[model samples]
Target: MTTIEQASGAEPRGGGVEHVDVLVVGAGVSGIDAAYHLRERFPERSFAVLDAQEDRGGTWWTHRYPGVRSDSDLFTYGYRFKPWTGPSIAAGEEILAYLDEVIAENGLAGYIRYQHRVTAARWSSGDHRWTVEVTRGDTGEQLRLTTDFLWMCQGYYNHARPYQPRWEGMDRFAGVVVHPQRWPVDLDYSGKRVVVIGSGSTASTLIPAIAEKAAHVTMLQRSPSYYFAPPTTHELAVTLRQLDIPEEWTHEILRRQYISQYHWLARMSFEAPDELHTFLIESMRPLLPEGFDVEKHFTPRYRPWQQRIAIVPDGDLFAAVREGRVSIVTDTIAEFTEKGIRVGSGEEIPADVVVTATGFNLSLLGDVAFTVDGEPVDFPQRVTWRGVMIAGVPNMAYMFGYFRHSWTLRVDLVSDLVCRLLETMQAKGAATVVPTLRPEDDGMQLRPWSDPENFNAGYVLRSQHILFKQGDREPWTHMLEHEQEREILPNADLDDGSLVYR
Candidate 1:
């Protein structure tokens, strides 16, 4: 295990120690973006990015699942500073490579410490610093670090363990059962009947990809989910390049495409439920089996966007179904049999492999224990300050985004605001900063900040409500149009309500 020490030049002990101006946890997209911005804003202050995994690209590197493609398009998912170079919406390896490229191009590797899992953090009111504790993955050594600020980029989806539905006789089943996250590389599915459980994006993507090689692929879902077919890339790219529009204008047009699609879907889910259902059925009609009931196989009971809508490129999943390569089983799994799985309809489908794309367990705040001067911090007991920052937590911010919109939209905005806030702190000679919302701030009453019905779990509960609340208010809510974000967050007030400076 090679350990690279920072230039502080202190003698290393068993339980190493270090201090810096800032500590950004989870070296994923959010963490890396935050660290880069901090360096740009505060070139003199030292900052470090720490991640539990030995490698970079948090989920991209850790998730070895089959057919792991992003739900969002590459054009919107890639960072503003770095343009993605892939043709079709890139796969997992492509995204990871893009992240690595960004890190290398920006020379961010020197500031990152891999295999450091942060366990706890405490705010010191007297010293105005966060005392962070972490475990070293290599040596199992506990280490302590201090920094003026703590930025959490650990996305909501990364920490929680993948959820697998419990079925009787699962252990007795002779065939292999695999969770997408733990997909066995050498397990051959060729010429074997495969049953994939769930209707989320992961399952949808996997069914199509695996159907091409497997003898038979079956998608089993307790209830159907809204699936939309979007173009692989925005048409704005072609038009802008053809028309020779300025890069800024092309970017603006692409931004509009993203915003329009998000709002159109959001509005359909919120207002025109019946119309949305009709639109979905019409779009899916050509793909369903001749006698298949569209309502039974495609219609969902929940409102649109109740859970996230899964996106497939040009109806690839539906096309797979149409080709007789994949089959849809709209029934709950009652139990597992030695030969296959039994459905609630008393029908047993023979399968040689079972893939559980069930869902995930939700955990907030990186599951990191927080304390103030050694007193435990209860997150549920406290109200959110602005949907991003929590009250009484000094110099800390969470990377939260909208469930209805692409996550990068909100993450980018939050990152921009964080940079501006840091610059403001430097200008004011502030050692610590915390946002305090007014007691009667109408922002809290805007919408269901989090969705209780959609049980995919993790940071969604806390962040959902927070993002919704911010969307209804100013400064907190930037217009979905990208140019607006570029302007608003950069100049937004750091002292809006009460950002106490010490």
Candidate 2:
């Protein structure tokens, strides 16, 4: 940590805001990555990571529902800089342990200030700084901080408020209703009938974990979602460890393997969707019970990779269904009955507990109110510069990760880009660097943050209006291709007309 430097015409000492070279808005995977890169790349600079939670592990720490685990493999989900020694599909506690190890080993614990929530940020071009308002969760005390650059890595969703649908008779139901986001820590489900709504990853993970303990668990969804059940452990990792290969080598090898596999799947989804869809559906057949209606329960109306496919470890969800521990009901909820829920098919399922695992509410910039030079930032009207920086916002970068592959892949790339941008500013002796629309880009068409035709996850579609827009030209678009970006971002031209420095 560096001593606070008072800016011109600003308060000093106790009543003044602390200053740093970079202020990271979250202590999650992205923030930690940013901190590590900053320390390694620019050791002379001062930076601090702030997170609203009492501890780190943003999503992993926030979500405490039973059977919560990564929907994607850990090899890719884990940071590229770290080697994940755990299973490919890891539990919440395992991930937290891994994060703790990273923080402890890197001596990054000192840079992170937990329980500090950023409520608003105001960028001052004249002062060449950003004044941020923070609320301390522990003491409920208000604080202020100023930084030369703002790094928004707080994640894409609102942790406190999850997407929960309201049924007409939810209040009339006699049993307890729960949303997985706010799962009760002490709630008992043993020997009780549980009905889980939604067939997304959360529901899939929770169903098998609670099925054995609960008397009966039913998955009720209006539409089906695709599922992929791979072995929890990758054979290559096993072989590498057996051969006494270095952990770094194994991590890189496995990370590349997963990325290549996902790339193939992504290309197949776009170029040969029917064949890819057939391959996915056929893959699930052998794992399911004999004569199981795969079309009714597992078939999604959209093409493969349109939305994220849930990863089921060793086909556990299917095994539970095979053993009759779990039942799948595909129908709209007519209403909540006193005992359970009534379906559109005129069938009433009995349940003592109901869990809504539908989805989450997308939050833009951690829902932090942002202003640039006394003007509020209307994100929906602004365009993204390479999916990292929002146009017209000076010295700020937000981490919006991938939908087809691991998010941290992009996080690593963005961290590199941001560092490079800072170096460019230093080299030019510029105080600010903002993405501005060039003369040629005057008539460029703006699209939604994400293309619905390619990726239309329900949560994204619902909150698309709040997300920043993407442009049609190069450097103005948010390209989701990790392979292409691997080559493009490293050599991206900082002197390009898309960015203006002052």
The candidate that wins on lDDT is 2
Off by over 4 Å in 1: 1-4, 7-16, 158-160, 235-252, 437-492
Instruction: Give the 10-residue window scoring lowest on summed lDDT in candidate 2.
Output: 1-10
151-172, model 1: which lDDT tens digit per residue? 8888766344766668898998
Q: Model 2, 402: alpha-carbon shift in Å?
A: 0.8
- lDDT score of residue 343 within candidate 2: 96
TM-score of each: 0.88, 0.97
Error of 1 at 296 (Å): 0.7
Pairs of colliding residues, candidate 1: 362-457, 362-458, 363-458, 449-464, 449-465, 450-465
Identify the leading candidate in terms of TM-score.
2
